[model samples]
Target chain A: MLRRLIARWQGIVLALIGIVATVWLALTDQLSLYIHPGTSWFAIVMALIGAVLVIAAFALTPLEDDHQVASDASQPGPAVHLHEHDPTAPRSVGSGTIRAALAAAIIVGASLALLVLPPATLTSAAAAQRSINSETSTLDQDATALVGGDTSSFTVKDWAVLLGQSPDADFFAGRSIDLVGFVSSSPDDPDNVFYVTRFVVTHCAIDAQPVGVPVYLPGWAERFEPDQWVTASGAIVPNPGSSSAEPLLLTPDEISVTDQPEQPYVY
Target chain B: MSPPPAPLRPAPPKPSTRPRAAVGLSLGVALVLLFVAIRVLAPEAVGDVLSNSVQDFFTLSISVVIESLPFVFLGILLSIGVQVWLPDGFLLRHLPRNRVARRVTVSLLGVLLPVCECGNVPLARGLILRGLTVGESMTFLLAAPILNPVTIITTYQAFGWSDGILVSRILGGFVIANLIGWIYSRHPSPMSLLTPKFQASCAHAHDEVRASRTRRSVAMFDKETSAMLPALFVGSAVAGLIQVAVSRDVLVTLGQNPVLSVFALMALAFVVAICSNVDAFFILAFGSTFMPGAIVAFLVFGPMIDVKMLALMRTTFTAKTLVQLTVIVGLASAALGLAVNALA
Candidate 1:
């Protein structure tokens, strides 16, 4: 009875967990943590549809004797049916037990991950694994247009693109810049240089690529640890060190710890 | 004329099943409330207990589920519609009579139903049960993700006819899908390609006729969820684990090599398990570092086969068949990528 019940309801249970979690995230304005804001409406709308179907399913299918009624009413014959629901005639009792156990595990795992766990942005570990500033082509913009545009509202991504395209230090030498991002140490010059990084999400967090602008600061490790959010403002200058690959780096005049913003990624 | 009159027994009170619906509804409501309560009451500090990597594993896995869940629901709902609401043989009757032409028409069905690759699994399962040949269903599954409007538009937007990346992906996906379908169409027993359990499902689904459409739809929702969600969760977890374990530097380092870059990006595609609609933009991040061929390979290979896609497909196809499908698709995509690179 328990096996049949689980086999029948696991999906609906999972659907419920996902719907509740999604709706909650939407309500709290935290959906962007996982998916892009552009897709949030679609996710929310689908969740709502799934919720209605689930409720309708619950209201229509009686809890008790559903297997007997469903089988008899749907198809009258020898009880061959959906494989997951055929526990009574399993080829082996062990296999049936195993299937049931696996189903239960999925239910429990999904519930815990989706419901009980708190929502979070991708951490520094992901950033480190993906390697900050390695893939910034998505941040690419026309360099000439960037030089002529208003510079004060530019993001770290905007600056990173400029640094990549027009790295003629003369262009950035006198330009004061301000940016907010998590800190990740440079691979080549870990001791003196760290990057101010943020993930650029195209569709969802799964596709998020880390983009950062290098900041040259000696003894930076003593004050700021990796993954700590910071707001740094300074003038861009030619790289004084020979270790880092970047041609120009941000030499901050004012740098301080800051809170992680509501939307940690730039789309 | 009975030899003896038997005493009547109380019929066990019939168990009052009239209230069962109410009970079920109440339980569902209670479950939702319980989930919400747990979510609200869970400690924020609980996240801090785990190390960053462990935390990221959960975060990444959860995000995949959260991102793909709705599309999965949409697929199942559509599956229900196809099986229950549509008249019998509605889809099959409209297709071309010739086998190859039928398969071609089937592959183009993606233009109408633009569900992502993960969602296509259930829909394909539905099509097979609805009298679509196994080979044709396979074609639909593979081609739908690439040929769909959203994916094509996104690829266009990302590359804009540059270096033939967009053209290569579309043509590659279409040709590979058709080739697989044609190869499998000649099999003496194509049903052997499916898992025993799914075969059993196909067998019984054909005989079902007496139930009301509503009941059958509900039952299908239950059965499909039972089959699909477990696989989806497991697939998501695996995708997440691979991302954390595999270093992108290893792959990006090979981006400069014409031949190796094709394989490297294909490997990246297998691990990332990103949705097809947005993968072009995702791969655009590597546009500068990787050769156009590598980008093309990533675009072509990713939507059809990935860790998550394999897991979901496992629900229907046998392990041996999946291995074959992956190899063939991988080779075809690599060939397309290398050709584009040589020309460039």
Candidate 2:
């Protein structure tokens, strides 16, 4: 009877652990950081239902006897056979207990390390990258503002908003901003010209879309390779005789190669 | 006198029959009570935290489901084809008689079929029923999600050609799948806990359908879809919850140390449980801190084991088999990850 009770309690304990983990994750707001925004609610609802079912199944079932027999039968054949010859077989449980304790300690230690340490360094690195991009883009936006006319269309909502919207503004009236991104081939021009491209992220990087503005400057092609990280400072200018063809254009005044930021992918 | 003798025999007891409606009503009542208790006792502090999380959860879940919708549709159609057009014993005939060859072939086939992790379970079961060996079936089960077309495209987009992340993922997946198969073949006893029911049902279902020539093929498709869809939804939900609840920062933080980082990322893979089709994008988003090798492990290991996979594993294998397989897959994945990192 005691063994049966123990077995039943173990099942319940597993279920409880699962439930607590799920609820804790939900309460932490970390869930959205990993998945798409559209399905998270349905996922939570279904998880709740599944957890309830699992817990109920454990609590209601009087199948401990069957479970024990199955477990015993399923024990690795060599181990069981060896156990049959040794009266000291039951003593092995102490070793199993020790192993379990060790595993628990490791799990706890890791969780603490994750919660407190790495985020600080990673966030700082990401912030440093963002600051560099912002500074360069601010210069370009100022240049564009001088060339075009006014700066009503280029309000910064966030880093992402600023990056995606700047390329569409009318040259000379557009914000003179510094832009930092990886070099990709310019879609409009092929000859020694490129676009400074960054990802426009809607949710996670999965839905990230590429956004860029044309960059034309002397010797710009020689300095930056495709996928090389760079920050370009330039004024937004209208392409000669291509007002209707090109949306917005930039002539870079200065450019510098920077170290690949920790968070290489902006989105 | 003869009639009296006949009447002397006692009548047999009637079998008791209970209405299904009664059972359902009681179940409904119990569920309602449980929900009430949870709602009443739920903490207010947690409520604020959950609001944004709930929103984020819905968003992510919808996006992933939408992205994988095409693959899911194609996979279901393929499953239907396996059910209807493929003749019985077709897979068995194609499968190699030699154990090692069979394992390799099945793993290759797993790469060919472009299904996500959730879809692999049914496909593996289907193949097993068609006479694939246990090791081969398991190989297919592990390899298919990792090697699919969608994953390949996403990996290319993520790491690009410069680092050779895409090629590494494919080759690494193939090697790991085979290694797992080889290990399991050498130690075949761990798999003995898989019940005969897994083998019995497919043949049984096929026989029943064969006997009924008048039944439309659509009927079988519908039946299988209906049975599998609920499990699929449940699995998707579990994956979604994990994604929402666990922070990316948390996962990245865990990836700091070399060995523990690999295990941590693998566990995160199991928890976040993103579909293999779209997981490449997520892994790529993890930033440059995540090693190419660790990302590969996450991609390879996640589809084979996760919350939803666990639920499915329960249906076919005993608890013991599931535990053994989980340990073996986890260890193999970690070792492969270390190897790739070292080579890089």
Candidate 3:
């Protein structure tokens, strides 16, 4: 009887672990950091469905033939390693027992890893590893989708795309821009020059690409911190040293720290 | 089921008297206690050491599962719906069987299935079970992920609809999937290619074979969930780990070398395993750095084969078959990518 109960509930226990991991993500409001806002509902729905499946398994075990559930409980092997779909194919020689244990181990390891870790957005180090374009003054208009219709709605990406499209460096001289992103900087940059970066995601966090622009807060540069969320209101100007380069320079008039936005990553 | 190798089919065993329950219960209890103790006592130390890259890795891994599971669910729902709800013979009767006509029709039929590469495995398994020939089904499996509306429009948009990438992707992907299907159709011992369990279970009634409508579907949902979820996590964890350890910037340096770049980007594509519908956005970041051919290869090779596809494919195919699929896909994408590189 004890053997019958274990075989039947093992799948449910695994499913329960999946549910727990998702719930942990949800409770911490960290799902947003992992996926786009539009698709977060699916995770919730999957959690609910996963719960239903676990519950159904619990109910079905008593009615099911004990031999039947035990077979399934033990069959996670070939299903993963060599799914013998053809009836005419030869019988599996490997132990189903071993495969089942492997499946259990993988699922448990993955779930625990996520549940135990702290939730975080990509770091400045990764932003560097991604090597996002820092100079956004001049951009290739033809290359990007052109998100904003006019100068007032310009994002960090729009400014980056403006590099090649501009007739010349003077084109952005007096353009006033307002933008919000987490503060980031190059590894060796001084206090005055730091980047304001936002991740642009086409699908999910896995594909999010960082788009950032260099901001020069001359007098107040030393007061800021990396990865600090802030709003910068500034006028665009060409960089003094690299006048011939296309990267636009931002000279901020007012800068203030802000709470991380509800939808922190751009879609 | 059928004495092992049954991922989905749950049939009666002869029964064992060993107390498997005690092992399971003890393990569960131990796992909970250990996790609680470690998480409560040592979280800060773990966080200080593992928070940055490790956290990103965890996020990437979980997000991959989060993104793909919905499509997997929908695919399973649709595939099993056809199996359980459709009166027998309905599918085989409606689907074309003329060699050329059937392959072409089914190949083009992929436009309707929106699921990407990771989620298409279960659906393809269903199609085969419904009597579609290996050739026809393989064509659909390969083409469906790329030819669908979501992938097409996204690719177009990602390229900013310039440089003929949209047309080239369509033309190139269409040709590759069809050719592979055509080639496989020539030598094919379809039965031997498949695992024996699937072949046997295909004839027999498994657990959900007789339940009522709701029960049947729910049972199927339970069965497929058990079968596929473990593989999804395994694949995602592998993919996430690779992404964290290898930086995208490192891959960017190889883009300067044209010949090596294609292979580099191809390997990157296989490792990243981003969905075809959204890979264009990811690859677009490489636009300024990588050549056109490398870009095309990344797009074309990735959707057809990747870490997720490899992990998922093992559930149904032999190692030999997977190797063949990989070599054929790699060579074809390389040829296409090089052709585009030469043109550029």
Candidate 4:
């Protein structure tokens, strides 16, 4: 009885793990970090239904009857006419017992790890590795603040996009700005500028693209370590960034260390 | 009215309740303790070194599973419904007997059933039981994941509504699916390509369902879950690790060459099995980096094959067949991508 009970718990355990993970992410309002805004609600609904169905299986098909059902499901009579269900008929489980157990261990182990650990957001090192700013075009459609009007409203992502649109840095000579991001040293930067980095996620953290604006902190860029969140206020200068065409650099008059935002990733 | 068959047994059933509970609780405790030790002993040493890329990967993996799980269940439910309610007569009656007509009918049927590659496997099995030919069913399996309407609109939007991408994806998927299906029709015994057990038991699905609805559904769910889910976790973990660890700077360098770019993005598509519904958004980042043809290849090939898809496919197909599908899809995508690059 105990062996049978252990074996039957396999599907149930997987279902429960899924349910727990989905519920935790949703309740914490962290589901947005993992999927697109357009599909986040849809995922939540799907997860709810999936969890319910898995739970329902416990009652709908009792543990003792699971193997019996599996036997029935796997039996395709060689006979010309379909015979009614027969337990006596030959059945095949194949090498399923060991394989299902292994799969369950890995899946359940991963789920539990997520629950126990404090959630980690993407870091600056990955931003450097992925080396993608191609999202400047698709990551933001909100930064259409009339070219000269309230340049202060732009974040690092908006500034990155706006700066790329114009040919000469002379276009935005002096625009006031307030921005927040983590610091990562720009590759091949002779001037030693620090890029205020923000990872923009379009659809889940997997597709996150790094975008940043150069901050001319000169001696101060070295004061902070990588991935440390900071906020700065300054005026935008028509200066070329480390890479790409005429990127707007920030001449932050005031800068301070800050805590990470409630949502670290921008949609 | 023969005597009840003896339960199949080899070893005696040992009492496992205490051992099972001990195993579960201790595993949990061990994991918690390991993390807690790291947090306490050298919190500063640990704080920055703990790469959130792994965490973020897990988050994405779990999210992908949860997001798609509903549809998988729905597919299972649909497959079960067909078995219990309408396995015969309904599908066989509507499908044509003519060879070319059947292949075309099912390939176009890809539009109605908008399942991604992962979710479509069970549904394809169900369709086969409903009497689709191997050629017809395979076409649905390959094409539905790539050329579905949801994928269409997303690809359109992902390219910011560039008609070139939209047109090429449909063309590439249709041409490949039809050609593959046609080729499959010539085989002496196409059923030989499927896994041995599935080939044996598939026909009995209807009779089994009729035996008891609960037993059948439970059985079906158990089979589906066991066959696919473990590989899913392993595939996600491996794919995520490689993506995070490997620098994409080479990807950028390769993107500049039209020929290399086609191969590169196709490779990326295979490794990163982003769902077709949302793959466009992923590819949009590469739009500025890679050529139009390369991006097109990424879209065309990604949903059609990937590490996750391979793991899922392992449940149904032989390794030799999997390799053939990969080569066919890869060459087709590359040819289409390169042709576009050369012409336009």
lDDT by candidate, in order shown:
0.84, 0.51, 0.67, 0.65
Instruction: Summarize candidate 1's per-residue lDDT along A1-267 as a digit string, tens digits.
Output: 465566557778888888999999999999999999999999999999988888867765542133332332222224434444544334554655676688899988888888877888888888889988776644545667788889998888888878877778888767789999999888889999999999988888888878888999998999999889999999889888648888889999999999999999987
Evaluated at residue A123, the lDDT of candidate 3 is 64
Of the two candidates 2 and 3, the one with more favorable DockQ, higher being better, is: 3
Q: Name the better of 3 and 4 by TM-score.
A: 4
TM-scores of the candidates in the order shown = 0.93, 0.51, 0.78, 0.82
Instruction: Report the error of model 3 at residue A9, Å.
Output: 5.8
lDDT of 2: 0.51
Please identify which of the two predictions, 2 or 4, would achieve the higher DockQ against the true structure. Answer: 4
Instruction: Give the runs in model 4 whose Cα sits over 4 Å from its true position.
Output: A1-9, A62-101, A132-150, A219-222, A238-247, B1-49, B56-60, B85-87, B160-163, B210-215
lDDT of 4 by residue, A179-239 (tens): 8998877675624577788888776677778888778766665578778899988877755
Residues B1-344, candidate 3, lDDT per residue (tens digit)?
A: 11112223334422421233334334455555554454444364455566567777777887787777767766776777766788877877877777777777777766877777766887777777777766667788888888899898888877855656777778888888888788888864875555444443343333345456655555555555655677778888899888888877667789867788899899999988998988887787556677888888998899999998888777666677789989998999999888888887
- Note each model's CA RMSD in angstroms: 5.5, 15.4, 6.4, 7.1
Residue B343 CA displacement from its true place in model 2, Å: 3.7
What is every candidate's C-alpha DockQ against the true complex, given to 2 decimals?
0.45, 0.04, 0.26, 0.26
Q: CA lDDT of A65 in candidate 4?
A: 42
Q: Name model 2 segments beyond 4 Å from true.
A: A1-267, B1-50, B57-76, B186-192, B195-206, B209-223
TM-score of chain A of each: 0.89, 0.39, 0.68, 0.76
lDDT of 2 at B81: 62
Q: Candidate 4, residues B114-153: lDDT per residue as tens digits? A: 7767778777777777667677778888888777888888
Residue-wise C-alpha lDDT for candidate 2, range B95-117, written one tens digit per residue? 77888787778877755787777
Off by over 4 Å in 1: A62-77, A80-90, A138-140, B1-17
Model 4 chain B, TM? 0.81
